[model samples]
Target chain A: MKKQIIYSLKSPYRENLDVIGFTFGSGEKSACIVGSTRGNEVQQMYICSQVVHALKKLERQGEITEGRSIMVVPCINYYSMNIGKRFWTMDNTDINRMFPGYEFGETTQRIADGVFRQVQGFKFGIQLASFYQSGDFLPHVKMMKTEFSQPEKMLEFGLPYALTRKPRPYDTTTLNYNWQIWETQAFSVYSYGTETVDEKASQVSVDAILRFLSAEGIVRANVKPGYVSRIIEENTMQQVHTEHGGIFKTLVKIGDTVYEGQVLGEVYNPLDGEKICEVKADKCGTVFFIYNKPLIMQNSVAYKIVDF
Target chain B: MIQTVAENELSVNEKLKIRKNTYQNGKGKRISIVTGTHGDELEGQFAVWLVGDYIKKNIGCLNGTVDIYPALNPLGIDSITRGIPGFDLDMNRVFPGFSEGTMAECVCNAIVEDIKGSEVCVDIHASNIYLRELPQIRISRDTAESLVPLAKMMNIDFVWVHESATVLRSTLAHSLNSIGTKTLVVELGVGMRINKDLGYQLLNGIINLLYELGMWSEKPDFEVRQPIVSFDGAVGFVNSDASGVFVSDVEFGSEVEKGDVIGRVLNPLTAESEPVKAVCSGLLFTLREYPVVYGGSLIARILSREEEN
Candidate 1:
């Protein structure tokens, strides 16, 4: 195991910001994994750390296949993480949006350029990503709808679902889309948590990466096949919205299978405690996302269900 | 007239409001000046205030409508942060936003929709906190043919034409240009603190532009300079080779010859100094305001005249 300084920026007050990457085995550039572009992505960092731990053990046991290399960068925005902020501490710019970045541009853009220059050109790129919304997601591997994206390769992750999403205007600058544009097949693995760490979800994420490595022949080890992964398109998901502004109470959780017209959550008047409306499933599907916030505004998205 | 473009109710008494003030005559060509996209850059706010006040005091002489958005991200300015405090989003990077979106999106939507059809749009800005820059006008290269003449009339020291594609499409100027509103971006001073001289100079520039555009009958009282026009490739940036404290030898807006010593990087522990020099003869439009810099940080931006068009 070798610890490398992928990028560094000098600070006046505090210590210089250094982005560290861990590499195991040495030969062909096989795979690269990035975690926690934002400071609040604790779960993603936890999963990557676990992956690093497992890969170190596998290297000691000589299970890593010869002539293959793998690199793991557990956290990129450590300054923000130290302050409990989500973006770059100085400019509040998101490192994720500045991929293929400008070396002479803003501070965040320089960091992005420095890091991307080191990580680009790998055969496969995996990013431990999180959602923009404050909610839970079922552990899944997501791929952008690009020419380089192949849904068949996602089955190796052994996650329950593999989702293909069309890139939005903002997504074009994301690490996943940029990787695909540069001819490196990119996959974003979304775990169940963002701000907090869920041990079960982290383990599931770490295992999924290991399973993918073994399947790709990067590691010569036997890993459990956890789930019969299903492929789904992003546009097919049904979004459930709230009709009233009130306190939100949901009994159903993410990944729960529900029938049509089933009660999902209830919105109560914030002042009276009386129920304003009850949110229900519109189609027979699996609850892929449940809003975890305690209050819901009118027309806010409360749930997203993937019809089976 | 005062109008609320967007509002967010964080608490009962605490609310975030994006307000716009307008002065109008019967009707002619409409012009909109917007600033305060980033919270830390406060010079634009002061310039807008000065311009807005000038228009208010001279409302009867106005030929067309003038819309001024003094503070777009009030919450950010209140906290002295660059991006919006709660959302952690840059207001400048969410232009032409969706109507049904988050708080920052809604604010962008409101501003874009309000100023979409204006005849002239001016986006004001201050340099980042790390650097101090001269008062200048920046227009995208693609829109240079139509906007350069107006940019030159802004009474600023330099007019820069940069590649539009190199910038993010989400920027207000880029979005406005896409919709046929050729926007001129004015960047001056430094972040956090206002440079009163440049602020008033830019304010006069806006008044001069309004007069040039036939939006106002009265002309600016002050004399404007013959602005030097620069293309994207003509700007030279001096970068540090090592992380250290930078002490600049020249001031912002200083003219330099080829191979002039512009600054030096000093290592406190080693007591070593590396002198930074200019590559060509031109105006130094941007200089490092903050002394501490990383190895890759820009020390100075010299507007070279080798290939000026």
Candidate 2:
């Protein structure tokens, strides 16, 4: 195992944009984990805990041995993290979008360069994403759309749900999205709903990683493999946007089966005491996620009803 | 035209000077008042000048020393812009500014210092050109309770109670809270013009505000109507998907009902009109003066509630 230090992106008003990564093992096979991609919560803390947990589980095994090494770069946007903002406080840009990372670019692009060097990889890249508001994840792994044939790395994680998603416009240049393009198997874990840190999901993710290592030749252990889970496609997704902006008071909970035209929540207008908004599912499905923010603006997301 | 300002710093907008005056009945309350934060919203700056002229002509209204950073971002005033000069930064956003920084930061730091010692601060503003906002005093309900009752006296149309966002980097009035200063935020009239009526209204409001607090002996006449408030109060937007003369259905301040036709987005090419309606009932707070519309241009903001007696 080896330790390395790196500088962060240089923004106008803040510091701590620096990052560091630790790698273990050597040879043709390697793996990387970068969490808290978003400067807010997903990275650097809760998800970082999951990776630390995985590393601890891997340590007891005689697997990461003589030839293989693992690298971990947790919480890249320490400057934004310091300010408790979602973007670099100085430039207000997402550090995640600066990929293939730049050396002399904007504040974010510079940060992109810092982590890009750490994540160049040997075998797999697991990026955990915590949903905004209240979308409880079903323990899914979003496999590469084109690289579905290489599900072996992901399947070894042994989670209940592993669905593949095509990259969205705002999604391109992302760690996983672009990583998939280079034939690097990438997975975006929808860890848990927004603003929440669940212990259960951590255990699920950590257990999955240990199982995956044993499944591959990395670890010589009693880990079970080949007991693959269900694979869902992206076609079964439906998003619901609230028509009005106001305090979001949800009436239904996640994991609740809902039908088309179901009342998900109400937006209360403070101008006059009234419920002016009605959110309904357009198709029969199950509720997955909803926003935690009550004071929403027009066109802000309200909920996600996955059509079953 | 550069002049060495206080403590020998080069000041921008060589055309203007830091007009210092205090309003304390010989007792000195250490008051600071600023206006024209946004160049386009000139009513406040005009009102400040009017008041400033009166103070200069006679004795000061302030007890302690007073500093007036009128048009703090002078370049914004020259270009009629909302942001500070050079960096396109909103001067209001960069509060407690940095010393070794952009021009905007330099000015902001200066303003914060100018009012740092003040016990009561006031930041004045103006509405956009198309709409008329009734003269009012805006007080941060989230701050100390000492300023609440005074805010009630501003005699405006609405006393908005809003939560603080991005603290320490809030509005000028909001920033004053961190320094333990009681601040009042006032806004009225259309932007860029001196409405004689609004000008008079604002001039009198400030006088009354200070007089009530014992800064002045005379009272500024206040409007008779008690203000109104709502949550994010009454945001009613009327827009035309079709272009034409936007014939308004109701006057400003008129009560509307759900599904009521508030106006029409008319297609002048075909001489046909599409009804511009209100999906939710509310009061008509603002309307577009220019009748012609390019698709998606908003015509009005209705403060939604149709219940009018």
Candidate 3:
């Protein structure tokens, strides 16, 4: 196992920001995994760190396949992470949105360009992604439904669910989308949390990556066979939104099987604690996501359920 | 008369409403003015008020409909955020939006539908708080032939014909232009604050544009300055070499020769100052508004005259 600095930016007043990648084996760049482009994505970063640890152990035990290399970039925006900022601290720009970046562009673009140049040509790209909305997602592997996308390959992760999302206009700039466009089979792994670390979910994510590597002949480790993932279209998920903005009290957890007209949560008036409205499930399905935040905005998606 | 362009219900029993004020005298060409797509960009707020007030006071000068759509992202404006407050999404990046999409997309779709067929539209904006931009109309090269002529009459200092690759396809201007609306994006001033002079300058340009489009009956008293059109000019970007509070030595929008001292990055603890110089002789259209700088922070962008020549 070799630890290498993939990209570095010299800071004038502070320590230079370095994007470090941990590589296992040598020869073909078989797979690359990235985590936590945003600062607050602690869980995503933690999962990558665990993957690196597992890969290091596997390589030491000669389990890593010869003539095949895998790269794990645990965290990219550590400068922002150090300051607890969600985006680039200097400009508040998302590095994740500046993919296939320009060398002569702004600070984020340069960093993106530098990083993308290093990670672009890998056979497979996996990103431990965080949701735009602050919530908990059921552990799954998601792929952008681009021309280069192969949804069947996502099942190799052996996660609970494999999701395929249609690429939107804003999605074209993302790393996962750009990777696929560049002919790399890209997948986005969504674990349980972003800011907070979920031990169970992190273990599941680490195990899933190892399982995939073993299956793909990148590594020769004996890992437990995970779930046969159910393929689902991202847009097909039933979104349950709250009708009132207030203190949210969730009655069901993620992965709970919910029935139609079942009360999933309740929005209470913040000032008086009066029940303003009940957020009931409109479809019978498994709860795939739950809003973890205490304060709920009206029309905000409180829960997302995948129909049975 | 005030009209609601788009409306969406928020969680707190309140509504996200995009309103526009219309001034019409008779049947004629329609012109639309859009502003406040970004909540933090307050320069457009002043321009919207000024234009709406002017049209109201001088209703006699109005020959056709003048639609002034202000505060496209009202929640962002209300919360003083660059994007939609709860969604954490940039309102400007979801243009030509999907009707069956998220709330932001639906609102954007409605806005696009409402402003689609106008003869001419001026979308106003201000730079982020970190940078101050001179009054400029930024047009993509693809639409430059048609839009540049209209942009010149807007009375802006610079008509920047940017390469189409640099323009985001999802931007309101790009989205509207793709659908055949003659939309011109006007960017000026700094974020979070109103620039009255720049606002009035844009207002005059809009008035001049109204007359040029045959939407205004009377000629305005103000004289519009012919803008410097940057079709082939390369923009010189000046980044800071040292991190500290930047103190500017030159004013924004001033022409400077190559190697000219634009600013100094001062480290107070060491009392050391590093000079930031110009890379080319050009018009400094963009300058840092926020003083804080890092090693790679952008200090200024100059429109190079060498390429133009």
lDDT of 3 by residue, A1-308 (tens): 88989998866567888899988899999999999899999999999999998898898899989999999999999998999888888878899989888776777888889999989999999999999988887899999998888899888889999999998777888899989988999999999888889999999999888888888999987778899998999999998877767889999988899999999999988777789999999989999999888987666788999976
What is the TM-score of candidate 1?
Answer: 0.90
Q: Over the stretch B1-309, how does candidate 2's per-residue lDDT look in tens digits?
A: 122222212221122233344433477465667887777788876677776766666454444444555666666788986655434345666676655433344556666766776767877787755455556565544662676566655556655544544432446776676788778777776677776666665566555666666767545545533555543434545555554567777776677786788788766556767897775786665566556543444566656553221
Better of 2 and 3 by DockQ: 3
Global lDDT scores for all candidate models: 0.84, 0.61, 0.88
After superposition, which runs of candidate 2 have C-alpha atoms over 4 Å from their true positions? A6-18, A42-44, A131-137, A147-153, A193-196, A220-228, B1-309
Best by lDDT: 3
> Candidate 1 residues B1-309, lDDT tens each?
999987764412245788988888857899999988898999997788888788788887789998898888888888987887755567777887766665566668878888899998999999989888888888877888999899888889889888765336888888888899879999898999998888788877888888888877877778976688898789998776656788988876888988999988888877888888887888888998888766666778889877665
What lDDT score goes with residue B48 in model 2? 72
Each candidate: RMSD: 3.1, 23.4, 2.5
The candidate that wins on TM-score is: 3
For model 3, the superposed segments whose C-alpha errors exceed 4 Å read A243-251, A258-283, B9-13, B269-273
**Over the stretch B1-309, how does candidate 3's per-residue lDDT look in tens digits?**
889987776654567789998888978888889999998999988888888888889888788898888889988888888988877688888888877556677789999999999998899999999999999999999999999899989999888898875328889999989989999999999999987899899989999999888878788788898888886457889988677889999998899999999999998778989999999999999999899887667899999987753
The estimated TM-scores of all candidates read 0.90, 0.47, 0.93
What is the C-alpha local distance difference test score of candidate 1? 0.84
